[model samples]
Target: MARVAYTTPEGRARRDQLVRAAMQAFAQRGYHGVTMDTIAAEVGVTRQGLLHHFPSKVDLLVAVLERRDEDDSELLSTLRAREDTPLAEILRAVLRHNAQRPGLAALFTILSAESVDPEHPAHDWFADRYRRGRILVAEWIAAEQARGRITSAATPQRLATSVLALLDGLQLQQQLEDEPLDIDGVLAELLALLR
Candidate 1:
């Protein structure tokens, strides 16, 4: 297997630049809107050069999603600021985080529809995302339950599934309609239910 050139500082920076350009393409044209030719041109690189980095569109999309995770990792710091309401803080942070990355969300917005099919590259991407998301939510729910802040009857896994479902449903609404979706309000409602 050919080694990906992500180890060097310059290589990493270049990779990030390509991912950002890919994100712009994702926002403007969605998943299908972007092509290898387009992304290569977007980065002012030759198609061959682009392929040298990302051999396929799936690779690039995976990188974009990974970039989202990396960017969202910054939300981790915000979680530390509030010790008492970690779950609430996480929900709020997720809201605030996506609010900043509408393009990233838009990327997701476009891809998620087609992601349902097993053939789609985005399918596994989203599945993995849901798994990780559920684990995080479950962890916080478990903590809250242990502290008697939440109901003991509600299993953390079940609550996590519900929370993630709400987030997905809300995002779907936001994408389908032209009106501005009340992300914070939706999160607040879900948070209240958790309590």
Candidate 2:
């Protein structure tokens, strides 16, 4: 039977620690490169110990993604609450925030590519996330157009798709290349084009 330590506060903390370690390992090494042993060694635990919290590598990855979603949701809510900030500026702030989180950025880059295979563990999750993201961005763009902040020459859906593509490409490039990204400047130029 699996150990029940994860039910207690200490156990939950330990589990969270394992998730953090796994995220770092997975970020540094692609999914195929890291194993249960690598993750357990990160936290000074045996493979069996890690298994007590996450029975399989897939489970660990899912847990890490879920934690990331929770964090991102909270951050997005806080950012959205800045009523004085325009959506464009809010998006630029998000990009700046992403640049500061290299580990998470790398994780997203690696996982997104891996999940393109329909058989991959996170394929559906990534697909759903992208679909929802595109929808939300499209809605935002349409609203901006209605307010006359954005030009109506292009469809909102197309603009949203382009914006998301730029964001993803920028994130990947920022990680793959050691060069610093001028996200704010790039975003400003894009927003200008939209206007």
| Best of the candidates, lDDT | 2
Question: Which run of 10 residues does model 2 get worst, by summed lDDT?
Answer: 1-10
Cα RMSD of predicted structure 1: 2.9
Q: Which lDDT values do the candidates have, in the order given?
A: 0.79, 0.83
TM-score of 2: 0.92
Which lDDT tens digits does candidate 2 get at residues 52-72? 888898888888789879978
* Backbone Cα, N, C clashes tallied per candidate: 0, 0
lDDT tens digits, residue span 88-141, model 1: 667767766776777777777777776888888778878887899899889889
- Measured with C-alpha atoms, the lDDT of residue 72 in candidate 1 is 62
The estimated TM-scores of all candidates read 0.80, 0.92
lDDT for model 2: 0.83
